[model samples]
Target: MALSVVGVVLCALVSVVSSHGYLSSPASRNSAWRFGFGTQTNYNDNELYCGGREVMHSQNQGRCGVCGDNWRLSEPRPHERGGVYGKGVITAQYRSGQVIPITIRISANHGGWFEFRLCNNNNPRARDSQQCLNKQLLTFADGSRGTRYNLSRSLRGDVTVHVQLPPRLSCTNCVLQWTWVVGNTWGICSDGRGKVGCGPQETFVNCADIQISPKRGFQKPTTTFNKNKNNFLYPRVSLVASVWFAGLVATIERDLEEDVLQTVVFLQRESIPDQDLFIRGGISESLRPPGCSSIVESDPCAIDMNTNLLGTIQHYEKYNAWRVGDTRLDWSGAQPGQDVYQGIPAEGTPLVWTTNNVLSPGYQELNT
Candidate 1:
């Protein structure tokens, strides 16, 4: 009898420790990450469950946790929104009508249905609750609603879903919450009148911080343009204007056709510091160079070091990519700035940006 009790306890421990899932692509709060926010890295991030088998709505009258946590339970699990993920870092930015992919990794197969929800937290820090996220049940482009991923049983593996963002919704302090509610657990109904599987069950949650704005790309470059006019080469986004110590400044002008974003880039090679750090900066919107009248169009995302102070904000300038000895911002297929150098050139020009905004193996982004 004693051995049987011990075996049961060990099995419960094993059940809790193994076979859970999390957002692997967008880098959930529990996921392993290096940049963005002060977070403690969890290499084994998938082990956390929302309520697990402990807190059932029928038995405990417990509420589900926000962001893969069960903080409101009788015996609450850790509040993931407060612990490792408190400093909600904006992992990604997208257009309101964009279709993005969410990938989930399940180490052990547990019969359950999963969901992805959103909360446009008014708080800049993205401190949203389960009540807030419940308002925005995200729907995949394929018409699968949140909590509608009813999995009867399945193999343990990675699952990727291509989800579409709502056409009208936009949020700076956005929380994309992923939850997995287990289905295998058997329990009495909330009223103690229903059959098995009619009560509370195991659940897991994970939240990813992101930003979404209405189509900010290149539809109206001269007018309303991509709000984040970041330099393609140097990848650190600076909130303050004067703190940007390196790279070119973008003064987006010239309204063109759909999906074709054309920007007049300026590189202030003079103000750049002699260090491993590189910073990308953006200037005020509208008009020509710093004068708003003396504009020069050399190539796309390239300037011939033609003039000083390219925009009205006379803080930064654009230079020729060949002059800097670095790769181009090839997002628009521009040939001038698209050259790639495997090493730091003999002239010691920092290859701050990458081929398509993705850094190479050696290049690292330094925060401002």
Candidate 2:
């Protein structure tokens, strides 16, 4: 009719920009991440009383939103209490190393025997926070994923504590919870719940915000048109395996067993004020203790300098590879510079990334 209604409004604007670039790719931005509530669940878990799927049964399943009953889904050892929980209380706060999981819902008939100690909110209550710490990060109840000690009662409703925090301790006040019931007991709780002292209302479900950047290597710029020559030197590595940022893709097995010899410099884009520029050649060196068999300096440099910025974000998606130079040296392998002005001797000393513009405060020494 009128150019067919302008061709159906340009095909609905190209199907809403191609469904927002396929749900913002990167594996759909890890399921569209959007959950931020340290307290969401007053009660509701009798298996939905009959039907099911309303709230409180998680291995990443359902509920935590809103629903109520005797409230089911709190099993690490909560029937009353048992074993496996050395001590507790942690309050970490860094931001962006990614490890946020947290889920603790407790209300077991409200009795006595209590000892719920899940850490990393600052961890240091006196040399190992009083010992007993078993690792795996605790989170039990048959559903497995460690860190939720045994508050034995035979186990049932109320008590879902799952913790995995890295993103610099992540903050909206950066989550923290530790409840060791009845004498020898500990404190420090804040992941939802303002005032409910008869004890039975401890909710904190942060879920996702993990973008760890402990990155390491993937060097590829002797300068010449910079195309990633031979690629696989420090090829790729970035982890958090579960909620996003996988990008492994490495290769260079000089007989294999962790043999690449350092070379981690990358940055095809993503320049948060010059986020590091680019430089890599086996970061500094030191340490080698797990059985020890040579390859000593201990073991510092390997993969993960943002794994070629996620392979240049899978072919130039956005960029995020920063780590070019300035004493942050934590690598330990490669050392052979004949050119590039001959100054290639940094298996350790070099850390300078922060220079896109605004050069004041003497560039604040690149914020270290």
Candidate 3:
């Protein structure tokens, strides 16, 4: 009995040590951050098989959260009030392809000023690129009405913002919605009707799978996100310039907080990123590398581990390879100019189809 008790105590001590030293270490702190990545797969059987065994192995298949097919997801945008009954919701409307304007309205009360914002995707750490319209005040004291602000070109698409107000003023009759005009009407609109404006319904299509009611909320004092944009309380991204790179591979399944773990290198800009960059779900469509012809037909936005991990890898030596025991390699590299399967050249050799026999399941690695 004493021995068993001792063993249990030792195990607990080891667990604590391991968790602090490795699991919670700066390098591995949030390695698996993703909103619903591990939920399930949505792809058909055939496509799942072709993508490789890793994707096919998931019992849920590609149906997991909003990772595939849809480039956006739905999350409650919270507003705050102190002694005031009304709550504000920051609504974002996507216009053109690159621009999005967000608007906030007070509901349930009126009068006084409210501060609101649109945070970074599920990853608050990703909100480093965030931009604010300003603190909005609606004075029902004078019987005026609510307030609205339009985000500039810099603050649009795949982003979030927050708004706040004081007490006693019940800001009411406010609704958050989107507007789509027949011919190019973009930007935050005062007409809070869904008749073309944006809302949870306009988020990523995959978000439809998960339904949320009364999508807005009151920003609590202990909120997981922050109100000030300059505090550096968000996620940090670093650049390893010169080498081509692609998707993120997580060692374990993570929650919404983990969504900021991935990194991206826009093929168009060969520069090392300086500012903290924010990215939503990766580009859904495939792209070819810049200056490359169509015959190549590769995904431009892919995550390439071959060139990065090639030299140091022990069991795996070749590029775009995968192995059974390997824990990493979870990203999708964009192959811009060449056929995705056209293996990386060896000594200037022409691109050739990689043989499956060598890196086959038990002994092989792949370029997923």
Candidate 4:
């Protein structure tokens, strides 16, 4: 009997950890991260606003928490005009036409889809009221109504949704609703049958208080694509060549009097470009110097100087391949001297060289 009880308890614990998530971006009402204001996992019912068990109908009063609610440990405080949390201040302020980053934190991977809804209810408590539920389903700037956006058809961990707020939204204070509905209950079962296939749907809902103002000449962000029309060589090529040439010049200028080992060390440090144009371009074999096109073991200049530069270049290329989602590149082959110049050791393989038991600080500083 004790073993059976333990097994049931373990199964219950596993179910609790299976699927849980909450809105993290635009700062939800529970974003303050207090003890009671965490993820609301009791999403079996339609508690759309703040995911609270009891529905809040008044703008002055807050949501209620059931005493033995097993889903979450604490209940979020009321976030209305005269409520205790946030002091009635808007959680976030933005203008229409701005790309708002919506981040959702998922504790466990579950098959589901996300829905974003917007309503111009300046009053916090009244926003999620039953009367306002239908009114808040906004017609987005693109003329789409009722669940403006959907993401992740399958199970996923953490995800971010970038959405441009409708330019038509000119409300002073508004509530943005985020709803996550579990796609299907495959493992959950009871009475020798699937307890819930995908019937009513287990849904998690949260809201963010935002103030949207008139657009003040805000231009939508765009990426500028400059054609490499000049000599077919990219700015990255010149940058790499310059670093290599600089190191060579420095090595020669300091005279053969400088220790070869010390010069190599200094060159490695000094040759590292201060900018991150190399990795941003997605490092590949195509970026190799034009002069050092093929494996020219015979050409002394290509073999010695270019090979050394290639080593440095390959290091960054390997780092880029590792950072970006490029599974094709053989990261294991990114060892120094893998691409040798005659008998001499060429560039160090990517991410192999380290300082203080970590990759060079420069690689860590890249924005991407």
Candidate 5:
């Protein structure tokens, strides 16, 4: 018992001190230091694979937190999205269909494979579920859709790739996630019947809140995805610039708070991400989760507001969802372009209606 106690204590220290690899560029949610978050940050942002196999294989049954958090908890922790972290901070911004280079810093190289996925969830008040991110798997924009990272062979430190954001897709707060499943662990098969070099292994993830907007000279494409699975959205896109919100609400409540619910209706500009938050959703062919496209249900102008009462405090049961909408549209030190929802719902702001003849609902609000 004493030995086991010592071992457990040692493991906890290791969890905080050392991690294999992490997303160093574009500022992931776990790694970046936002003023709103104070000093509350995950010291071991890279070591997040269900607390290693001891917890992953034994306790959680291969489950993982959407943003590389420990799987033992029933829900995401405080540092996770929708978990009352830095007010759903937006770290970076990019234009849809632009190729941007992503850098991964490997501290301890464990031969493995990594993948990048995005969930265009605009609401800054909900957890970024794994089911939602699975729908849109990102690929290298250089025509390498089914990208197989060659990390398993030699141990390299930094790996950078240029990827293109989906065309014609925009979001106020999108979760840009990077997951790396380690390839070192050897284990028995699921049946426990046969041995394998790569049955189950440690996984790591890091996420960043990002905003994607329409390009200056871009027009909405009428064409659907290409037949070839490799190039799902568009043909090979050359390197242009780069990459990139929403998650949980607040734990505390204020006595009086002012808010606004707005919509957008413009696609022809240098760029217009401010009014695109509610442009995508159950347009409901698939039975995916709510806010898959955008929280507001449909866009250039989505409301992202729900049935919550306008001017009064309410119980958890009083809101459509405890997680969908937020109080503020901006963050503390928001960068110029990274600031999405710029002219968004505030106390004094009035609700924005869709432009005439834009083929939109009269309004798109019903979210938080």
Candidate 6:
């Protein structure tokens, strides 16, 4: 009599635990239940796949709540590894274009077909973090659609399944969902009167969070440059010179008087043996000078320069015309009449050019 009583109690306990099923191999969020942790099972609604119960049913009386649309029991939670359920758990990692092994623990197999779905955590439709609900069916790496794995009769104990991830399916973090619907039940009422029936009408859902690594041996395009290229050799100097020359030309021709004419002349020479000099000049309203116009021109009708001059001689490796050097020229005012022009020289600086307004026309130049 004692042995018979013990056997009955064991069978009763197994019946209570086997009422629902969950993913066991990939370590689901509900794994804590197997070790005497987590909330108690509510047999009335067995859709506790992601640590919560489905409060609503689909239009065809199928399972809901996995998509986070209508979870009646509790709010959605993060589906990461290592919480109250397991120890030092890491998110399951898999590679694209590989076959993944799946194991499910069925307390009492309700005789159903296993269906798998994948959700990209990065997708905008995902509600809870790392939870795979409300996503469309996943496609395998071989370009074939992933459908149901049908079972003819009730299956008890642990069941194993294999799924192939599509070679092109790439995601950093993802959720893999497994749903078991009892055979021939279609997750709907067995009787036409919309009443729940036994056997094929039952459903079990669970999920596992996973990370997908990209395929190995993939190469990315690279950019290359040659040292002998002109642009690569003196990129900064070339850029500066082009910009400066454009600004100088624009300044010489801007805002000319209706009747006044403008002209520009550029002279380059290597005749003075081993020396290169470039001279650029143009005529416009004397109100404008190439480099100092902004400071000196305050009046709209200011006097114009008959001859505007700009000269450059490259000597130093870091030479730039805009910088102050051993020799500097200062000019004030933009009116047609003679304006102040002063030459300040430092030691060892050679005289390049000078001008005396009294000895020339409206503009004067003395070059050495």
Per-candidate Cα lDDT values, in order, are 0.52, 0.26, 0.22, 0.42, 0.52, 0.42
Per-residue C-alpha lDDT of model 6 across residues 1-368, encoded as one tens digit per residue: 99999999998767545557667766565563443334323233333532222223333244344522234434342222222222222246676677888777776664657777876543212344324344536543334555767654456677877788766454434667777765423333445544323433445666555655545532111222222332322233543355644444333323121112211122344435776554322112232334433233353222222222343444422112222231122222222232221332222112111121122222222211
User: Which ten residues in a row are the worst by lDDT in model 1?
Assistant: 354-363
Candidate 6 Cα outliers beyond 4 Å, as residue runs: 1-17, 32-63, 67-70, 77-89, 122-126, 129-136, 139-146, 152-154, 183-200, 219-368
Candidate 5 displacement at residue 66 in angstroms: 0.9
Local accuracy of candidate 4 as per-residue lDDT tens digits, 1-368: 99999999998778544556666666665553422334333333223333432222132143322111122223233443333333434556676667677777776654556667676654323324424434545433344444545545453655876666776454435667676656545434445555534433445666666766546433211222223532222443554566655544343323212211110111233345564432122122443433432333332112111112223465555333333222111212233225333344333222211111112221211110
Encode model 1's per-residue lDDT on 1-368: one tens digit a residue: 99999999999778756867877767777773644445676765675565556653544465556655555543223434445454656677677778888878887666777788888662442246778888888777776544466654556687877777876565544788887876656677778775645667777778887766545552233443343543332235543345343222221122222332222222324434542223332223232223232121332422211111224332321222222322222222223332333442222122232111112121122210
lDDT of 5 at 39: 33
Name the best candidate (by TM-score): 5
lDDT of 2 at 135: 25
lDDT of 1 at 34: 41
Per-model TM values vs. the true structure: 0.53, 0.24, 0.16, 0.39, 0.56, 0.42
Clashes (N, CA, C under 3 Å) per candidate: 14, 69, 67, 2, 19, 11
Q: How far in Å is the alpha carbon of 105 misplaced in model 4?
A: 0.7
**Higher-TM-score candidate of 2 and 3:** 2
lDDT for model 3 comes to 0.22
In model 2, what lDDT does residue 175 have?
17
Model 3 stretches with alpha carbons more than 4 Å out: 1-110, 119-368
Report the lDDT tens digits of candidate 3 across residue range 38-152. 3222222111111222232243343212111111122221111110111211111221111122222111111112222221121111211112211223222222333433333
| Local accuracy of candidate 2 as per-residue lDDT tens digits, 87-182 | 211122222333333333333332223222322221111222213222213333335555435444444443433344432221111112233222
Which of 3 and 4 is ahead in TM-score?
Answer: 4
